[model samples]
Target: MKLYQPGDTSRAICPHCGKLVSTTFAYRDVPFEDGSGVVKGILAAVCDECQNVIAIPAQSTPAIRRARDAAEISLEVSIPAPEVEILDAAAYRVDPSATTRFRKSLFAFYLQRLRHSEETAEMLRRDFEAWNAVKTEQRKRVSRGIRIPHRRLSFKISPKTDRDVQWLMETSGMNKTDTVRSVVMEIEKDLLGPNTPRELRHLQDIAAVVNA
Candidate 1:
């Protein structure tokens, strides 16, 4: 009943091809029974040869069952009807379909605003690039098998510092841990500027070589 790790392989008889085939564990979005929602990144087994999908048995695993419950709750939660209507009015002008689309047409709609100039489009592009950079760094860390250990820290700070942290949290739309991590990284960059220790600099050079 344990969750399957990604890239784990196993031998399975293919139902369609009736041959012994290798299967790999992967994460995929699985639609719910009512078809109204999807469970994103659910554990699944995929046949390498036939590309067949086999969903993990959620009922058999307590952890998976809890995750399914959380996903179901997220799906069941509804936005206010009036707010949805207002959003739909603005959104439908571009795509008109109930389903969201991230195609070029939608991108063009943002680039050439219905009423305004290209400033908003530029801002959107800049924001997207920044987000993509952060995601790319995270992917690199994962690829390198870098583990960021989690430790509980309980401390007190000045009211001004607390307000600043709160403002950062609100502006960046990031949770406390991410906001703190970003702030720490910024401070570390400044501290490591020109006179960084030889050992640390050597480590950084090695990391650059590995990343290259």
Candidate 2:
């Protein structure tokens, strides 16, 4: 999930209470230009419940460069949870070139929604169309593709450490693939013993990572 904007409010029907409620959730949206000169749009999912947000591409816009040196940057923003999901969906459909200008207007719509804003949402959509033309031209210059290999592997979560992807990323500092491979191998050795022969079944979960 991508992050919500700060101070952005949204209205939604509460599932738990079945009441129409409005609240603000905190999140961040940032745009990064990659080495290929391509700018990838990103959204972060900030959970207001615990104030934890994870950074990821807003939709699937690839980040051309590393986190630093991004062309356009925005701070963490807050919005209502339902609106946050709406914004997240919009991000998925947003064109990378117009990310900055479009997102700025989206923030305005977020504010309107908080105050019950249908008019404001309409206004924001108008601005989004206008901004797209300019940004699209700029993004064309830096289009390139970079590939990262993945292996499919799987393993049972150990009863001791439990299965937590975030914990492993934090502790191991290895990319997702390596971490999974290492954990699966360790589990296979422990569960089947070192003498267990290697075969399709033996590598069941582990193979997913390999194929991934």
Candidate 3:
């Protein structure tokens, strides 16, 4: 691979302009691919016409990796036992070896999906509402319903996902733990279904990298 420095000129396809365009390498603050945080003053290929940071050069990768690692936030949630099983099951289904590591990746994947679209976020909201209703009814009939054991799950997440979780909580009107539970419920429905999940290959790809 070719390394680049500031002032090096190149040609590449520009997504903004939707065509092949001339680019110049320069030092600039570039946001993470998901637009969560910015890595300051990195050498990147900037589109000539659109003036956007089109791509990071090979040599600047280590700096971006360091920044990304530092930007990760901890996400923790106490969920019922079933949710834990569901998450692990989904992870195992994706890749038996990466079961534990993929839990974080699985949640992050859903976070990105739900963050970008309101329709997708509604899945979490609906699941949350259903859970609240069940818990309220169980409280009313305290002697009858069995209390499920709770387990705590914690992992480091990207800054973008942290923001997404906040947005999800705001829209779903649910606390962080319940919101996380709802996400697991959604995952159970999709990943554990009899029909092959549309994202099976995609998730497996993610699991491979996370394990690596």
Q: Choose the strongest candidate by TM-score.
A: 3
lDDT of every model, 2 decimals = 0.46, 0.36, 0.83
Displacement of the residue 106 alpha carbon in candidate 3, Å: 1.1
Residue range 15-46, candidate 3, lDDT tens digits: 99999999999999988878877889899999
Q: How accurate is candidate 1 locally (lDDT)?
A: 0.46
Q: Could you give candidate 1's per-residue lDDT for residues 1-212 as a string of tens digits?
A: 45558898877877876888888988776655545345666667778987766546453245444544554321011322322333333334323442332221222222222113244333433454475477568756775975434343223332334445555545555555554444333323333345543344433343344334
Tens-digit lDDT track of model 2 for 41-114:
34443333343333333443343334343433322323223323333334333332333234333333222222
Error of 1 at 114 (Å): 49
Query: lDDT score of model 3?
Result: 0.83
> Lowest lDDT 10-mer window, candidate 2?
154-163
TM-scores, all models, native as reference: 0.27, 0.19, 0.65
- Write the number of the candidate with greater lDDT, choosing between 2 and 3: 3
Runs in model 1 lying further than 4 Å from the true structure:
1-3, 16-18, 33-36, 57-212
lDDT of 1 at 90: 32
Q: Which candidate would rank higher by TM-score, 1 or 3?
A: 3
Question: Number of the top candidate by lDDT?
Answer: 3
Ranking by lDDT: 3, 1, 2
Task: Name the regions of candidate 2 deviating beyond 4 angstroms.
Answer: 1-42, 47-51, 54-200
